[model samples]
Target: MEILFYIVPALMIALASCAVAAVIRRSLRISRAWNSGLTAEARCLRTYTTTSGGGDSSVRTTVHHVYAFTTRDGRGVRFEEQGGPGTTLEGDIVTVHYPADRPEHATARPPARGKLVAGTGCLLAFLGTFILFAVGFMVVTYAMFSAVGDFSQP
Candidate 1:
């Protein structure tokens, strides 16, 4: 029981550190990919619905899309990604960034909505970590003080 006082805070700190690193890594990846090329219009070739996580745990529907685009040098390229509702649809024209030297590598050009969502998630994780650690520290400190008792009176 008392051991939990130390263990829980350690776990909370570790979780926060790992989540922060992950968010940073993801941001770097997107930034590098976008800077790799110029924007090009891509047409969604096909879309399909996929179910993820079910059975009273977690469940959500995601749209899988395949897009085709022609590069500046007249090379046809295809890219696929999964997105939420209405994010991807058949025949929908979307702007994507791709390396001129490598049409095979392409990504949606800085989707504002996705960035907002990711930022919000990272913020929440950090906030939760702080709250958890503060509460745990208070509980442990209170327990230790109470155990020591008032020594001023001798």
Candidate 2:
């Protein structure tokens, strides 16, 4: 019983860690999907006028024009692209990484390596939690039965 008190808490912690890790992995996958189908060809830096919502405010700001060169199974595909805030602009020529099996599906930026790492880590965490729970349950059950046996002994 005393041992079970300790094991139960450890099991709960491991399970909670596994849940958080899973959420992180899912977010990574979404980001990878959005980036995978983009390619870069050229960039144009110029000042453009920006407008706010219903407010009477308009501003001029410098923006970069990004052109992407996409290829689908050896066929060329072209698209005009732009960089969002906080994203690095690697000049006119940008490397696009795509799935070899599906060339049409590509990204301007390489897929994140952390996603794979996080996924593996989460899986391991879940496995560890289950193992701890199983072992603790077995130990507690055995101790309970042993106590019963001792009480009945003549």
Instruction: Name the top TM-score candidate.
Output: 1
TM-score of candidate 1 relative to the true fold: 0.54
Q: What is the lDDT of residue 73 in candidate 2?
A: 44
The runs of at least 3 residues in candidate 1 whose Cα sits more than 4 Å from the true structure, single-residue gaps closed, are 1-25, 84-87, 109-154
lDDT of 2 at 122: 74
Q: What's the lDDT for residue 11 in model 1?
A: 77
User: Where is the poorest 10-residue window by lDDT in model 1?
Assistant: 24-33
Top lDDT hit: 1
lDDT at residue 35 of model 1 (Cα atoms): 74
- Compared with the true structure, all predictions reach lDDT values of 0.72, 0.52
lDDT of 2 by residue, 15-101 (tens): 766766665665554455454664434232322334435556655454333444545445554433333333544443556554434
